[model samples]
Target: MAAPSAGDRGPRVTGAARGGTGRPALARCVAVDPTTFAAAYWGRAPLLSRAAQLGAPDGFTDLFSPADADELLSRRGLRTPFLRVAKEGRVLPETRYAGGGGAGAEITDQVLDERVLGLYADGATLVLQGLHRVWPALIDFARALGATLGQPLQVNAYLTPAGNQGFATHYDTHDVFVLQVDGGKHWRIHEPVLPDPLERQGWGGRAEEVSAVAQGPPALDVLLAPGDALYLPRGWLHSAQAQSESSLHLTVGIRALTRYALVEALLELAADDRRLRATLPFGLDVADADRIGPELTDTVAALRAWLAAATPAAVAARLRERAWAASRPAPIRPLAQAALIAALDRDTRLVVRAGLPWQLVPDGERVALRVFDRTVTFPGACAPALRALLTGAVSRVGDLPGLEDDRDRIVLARRLLREAVAVPADDLSGS
Candidate 1:
């Protein structure tokens, strides 16, 4: 399967809380137990969870309804990269249905429902990109899932009319959870031609092999209805077409880690080594193998030395930090926080920021508190206060048990708030 063009996919992640914490959305969204799925099928094969409903109460249906499509298309004036129209396995150009000039000379693409609807009537699939950024419900759900899975997450939606297909048989670079939100879609899933492909190894060049394999009997073929979900691991070939009724499904892609990513983190850590940072022999060129050979050999030896010194645990820790940096932080209200910080007091309630992952390390006389893309070191005497503050339980700044000085405790609390490691207990939005 060829990957969608950059515009079709749009900029990814250009886009959460406690009490609803610890519970991963995936647990509720899958029919089989999460443990069972992880142990048996995760990164191994396709999983079809029948009658799975994400975002409970209202289910996934409320996230984007037919009414929403009508409202967004006719009134939102969406531009390219936000919406894409594909027909018969090909994506239609934005200009085909979008325009540049209007009565006011507006430059953005105005999504005319009539034009979009007309294309849909003729079998085009409408794709909504970056829904996690645009929809609040999806944002919360994505965050919950990310925290649960310990990976970055993104969301997209595909709406295909009856008896139509969006794209030809293909595989995704990232694992996807396909949630059928409305109507039904017939799916044909084949075993991976190349199992566990990396991000750079896309689906484009392997079309012939994919086609050849797909011609044989599929490993799994079924019709997915509303509230149903299909989990396809990366590199698993699959395709789906709308049934007699139109279909709308959400694809929640997990940007999973690979060995290559771990190596990247290792390389970054190695850069600090003088040997790794040294320049190659000068005047090295395609024709100068004699000189190039020794230089290349030396570089390889140095890299090997770096690798030999590396421990798996240390490398894993670095990769974990990199992943945390890439993920979006728990939601925060800047204005509210600023106002609250200005009125800092002993009576203010604080709790560890919902869904925020943190680490505290002992640093001799100081304690290193690492969180929210930054690290702060405080006197070891404040360890009790810091530990209590990060216990995920709510507490008033004034009532913290171990800390006695109101001034010092208040200062530490304010610093924690500023770093986004904790939030006021009253702010439900932050939670």
Candidate 2:
């Protein structure tokens, strides 16, 4: 790809790109009506939203920068798989680009900047995988989106050198939103050969077929410039190549849960049932096959009935719990937080920890505040105040809506602070 000109670069937007109070920032990143997106093109078609000409003016620069790649490559000591090199649709082994750790022939998978730069100059696309684990900005973005979508999220970055393509036409197992950060890239998207393919179904098994179909007409073809965003459903065949200069883009992957997954989870839960736990009859020939078939049919019918009686809301709640538990909170300093809590008072300005989801459930005379895998209960009278803390802006213990007595509000605030559910408003902004 060719270098972007001065005109292509614009003023930078700081802070997180967000839509509305309840809306996910991702909704604004794609420039689409969230309701329309969910109802129409969510898992159906490809949609391109040209939100900006360059350097998206919607505070997206806070999520990533070109310098991030340089830091990871030249200083972070990234390992295999985390940093991969691909050229002309083929992946080069780490041994070809990575070197050993300092002072030893240990063959650590650390990236040697000179070697990686050399490979990049030679047209190898630099692939940085699982960036959400290492990049703080991405972790915040992914967690926020995951809470909005009620599923977990992952992020990866692709840095392709000018005029080079990383891989052949293929489909992703998970849905992807491509955020073009720098330079430009031409993309061609084709209809899915296998609609809604499972994670186990990869393009490697049918490369020739994919190449053949990709050679035909494309469903959508366009050049994505900086700040442009493209959403593609899982199983949509696509390929991209840098225009004439290096291209840097981030891919946020959404691994949506399917009804099949719910059924699998239910089956695991059903293992405790005596009927499901029973072993099959002793081995025999065709003589016993007919009897076994009838029993198996009966079991299937019972399982279907059980599944029918299972509530959809309950299943969804279970999945949400799992996703939240799997997500890691942004790093926190225990000692600093402890000190802040010790000094906390009614005047302390606080906010719900960013990226942490809190749900209030009423249980008889008590209200349970569920977050991560833990639930803390307080008197039902405190619901109003807890709700305010969960949903409102930076607030002080004195500002809790339902609590009339300052001492009561302060006690509640101290508990929350000590539990790390709420942090100082100024500290929350750092993440």
For lDDT, the strongest prediction is 1
lDDT of 1 at 105: 57
- Residue by residue across 1-431, what tens digits does model 1's lDDT show? 12111111101121112113334477545666667878998899888877733434444665567667667677776666878999988999997777764687568576666778789999999998877776666777777777767678788889999999989998889999998888999999999999999888888889999989989999999998887888999999999999999999999999998888988978887886799788765766847887678878888998998888877766756775777776665687888888888898999988776666666777767778766477688888877787776774438898665666899888888888887777888876445
The C-alpha lDDT values of all candidates are: 0.77, 0.76
Looking at candidate 1, what is the lDDT of residue 279?
A: 74
Task: Supply the global lDDT for candidate 1.
Answer: 0.77
Query: Taking the tens digit of each residue's C-alpha lDDT, what string does model 2 give over 1-431?
Result: 11111111111222233323333566645676667778888888888988552234653456777898898888877887788888988999888888787876476778889999889998899889888888877766776676566566788889998889998899998899998888899999999988888777888887888889999999999998887899999999999999878899989888877776776667765664567676666763436767778777868987777666666555656665666676755555578778887787778888777666567777778887777769788898888888777776337788887776988888888888777777777784323
Model 2: runs farther than 4 Å from truth? 1-24, 51-62, 77-81, 99-107, 284-292, 326-335, 360-368, 373-388, 391-394, 398-415, 429-431
For model 1, what is the alpha-carbon lDDT of residue 234? 97
